[model samples]
Target: MTRVVVHAGFHKTGTSTVQHALAQNRDALAPHLRIHLREDFDPLTASARSWSVTRSDKHFAAIGRNALRFFRSIGREDTRPVLMSSEDLCGHMPGRNGIAAYDAAPDILRVIADNARHWFGPALDLVIYFSTRAPDPWLRSTWWQNLRSTRLTKDLDPYADDLPRAADLSAVVDAVRAAVTAQVVTAPLEDSAARPEGPLAPLLDLTDVPADVRAALGIPPPVNAQPDLGMAEVLLALNRSGLDDEALSDAKRTIRRLAVKRSNLSPHA
Candidate 1:
């Protein structure tokens, strides 16, 4: 039976970095895993946010259908467990301006389960996986991450400590376990590079990367690791600037070029 492993993201726990790594290593992972990485997990990105925000079931049901279609498009005849990664899956998008969003909305999980069940038959089991970091660092990292990013909210105060703390994730964890009625693994975000399967292995319920395969394929450097502090500070200041949207976009390009040049010139860079 085919199963679904959902990486329902609690953002700022390196979701982008993980997704980047998987995309980069897709060829390497293909023999061991049948992965689906590009589904639109964020509801706000859909064309009908106002309507979706109102009819959550209908909104997520459509997402479930899309996911089913994607699964079939990948030649679903195989019995491989489907691995999916999406920080937006759980839909608890903490606004960039530091606001609390949903702490527990199991109905979204229910929507997916129901739709998937109907499409894939009742025997298809769905499970969830998540990652968390220490609260203080998680809060700070999230603030820095949202500086140049916007979706749920715009114009975060880059210099302020006014960002709200994420709620104890137990609230959502408990909700997910109840919603899915399946095993849920919560992995820590730190020191995961040392793991034999790397950080995402636990999500797939895998223990180790094959030694022979690891030897044969040289793993590339990470794709979307957090930028160094210097670059992050520069990006933050740029985000807080008075420039309009188009000008701000242009300024980001200019700033990135200048930073790269300075880095190359510096002996330590």
Candidate 2:
């Protein structure tokens, strides 16, 4: 029987770094585990995100149907443990579309658990893992992300004040535990970032990828890091400028390019 580990997430918690490492080391880890990331579950992730906004039963049902279809397509004869990671599996990050918390996560995860049990049977070993970060940093990072990607005009302080409950990620995890029968595990970004493998340490540990292979795999530099303070301030200003959408996008692109150049030339970088 194959063991399945799903790293559903609380975002701004180094998920991109872990996913990057896994993708970079795919061939090296192939013998011990099979890896799946967000791209492999387009329909499921789409439905999950849709349900996050609409909260319609039909969209919710689509989540279960898509999940089962994805699982069924996997090769049954491959006994190697499967590790799938996607922050979207839970739902949209809080602050997106006025979402205050991962309130829908338990139900979404329950659907996933039910479908997995039905397809993989009683003998299947299923584990759900959540990667979390300290509240202050998580909130700040998430705020910056939204400012960059969306037209969010609020600065970090106000954003944090408005979405206080989003920081209580443990409560979200507890809800998931209550909703699903599979073992639930959590890793703090503070602890995992200090390890030799950086953010990927917890996941590599779970998949039991050999030490030699781990050492040999190329670890990429941090992925999707928040822009520096100066850049962040500029992004906030641009967001509030009320420039036309196309002009706003053009200005942001210019600023981002400059930020990258500055970062690459910095002594710390």
Candidate 3:
């Protein structure tokens, strides 16, 4: 039976580090499981757009096919664990705003469940692993990495914001949990860094790849990296500057174009 692990995130949660380590150490980890980064298995730059809520046909077709192929590969493999890492698996807009922000929670959850079921085949178990950051810092980190809009965030300090409404997390979790066997594991980034053995144990347990494999993959057993304060300052400045909707959209588009190009040009193969 093929085992599937979906590290659905609470984003800016060190997902990049996890994915990087997994990809880099593929050979060492290959025996226990094959790690599938979205683009490698699927030619489309799957995470280049918010696919769940994206309405564009071109985007949908490219992402959908890749998603299907991802599932098919898992089904065909004899591996003990097939790891799929995408922070987007968790609900986006983990806020109070309604569909105006993104698709409804249920719709997004359904799409994830459908993809997992299709890929893992019948009677699969699911785990939703996540990490926490104090909300303010997490949002600040998000703004930099995604290059979010100035206007939309004008009055708010992401760090000052509350932990996403429990109702919001619950609703999204329930939608996906109801369809499959699910468990929620939360690790605060700081704590995990200080005591990887404590907070990160569960993640390692779930993945069950050897320590050597983890080391080879460079999955730092949780280490501290400086929060790029300059990046955060620029993000905050963008919001404070108040670019209007059209300008913000153009900024976001330009950022995405560059990001996609960079992701495509990666030297790792």
Best lDDT goes to which candidate?
A: 2
Ranking by lDDT: 2, 1, 3
* TM-score versus the correct structure, for each prediction: 0.75, 0.95, 0.63
lDDT of 1 by residue, 104-218 (tens): 2455555555656666675676677787767666665665556546422333353234434353565677776787656677887776545654565465454234667654543
Off by over 4 Å in 2: 265-269
lDDT of 2 by residue, 1-269 (tens): 77889899978898888888888888888998999999998899889988988999999999999999989987767888889899999889888797888888999999998988888897678999999998999998899888888889887888999888889999889999999999899999999988889888888888788899888888877778875547888888898896999999999888777777777632212
Q: What's the ranking of the predictions by TM-score, best on top?
A: 2, 1, 3
For candidate 3, list the clashing residue pairs, or say none: 71-119, 136-159
lDDT comparing candidate 3 with the true structure: 0.52
Question: Candidate 3 lDDT, tens digit per residue, 107-167?
Answer: 4444555676776667666666666666556655544544453333433354324434422
**Best-performing candidate as measured by TM-score:** 2
In candidate 1, position 171 carries an lDDT of 65
lDDT of each: 0.58, 0.87, 0.52
1 versus 2: better lDDT goes to: 2
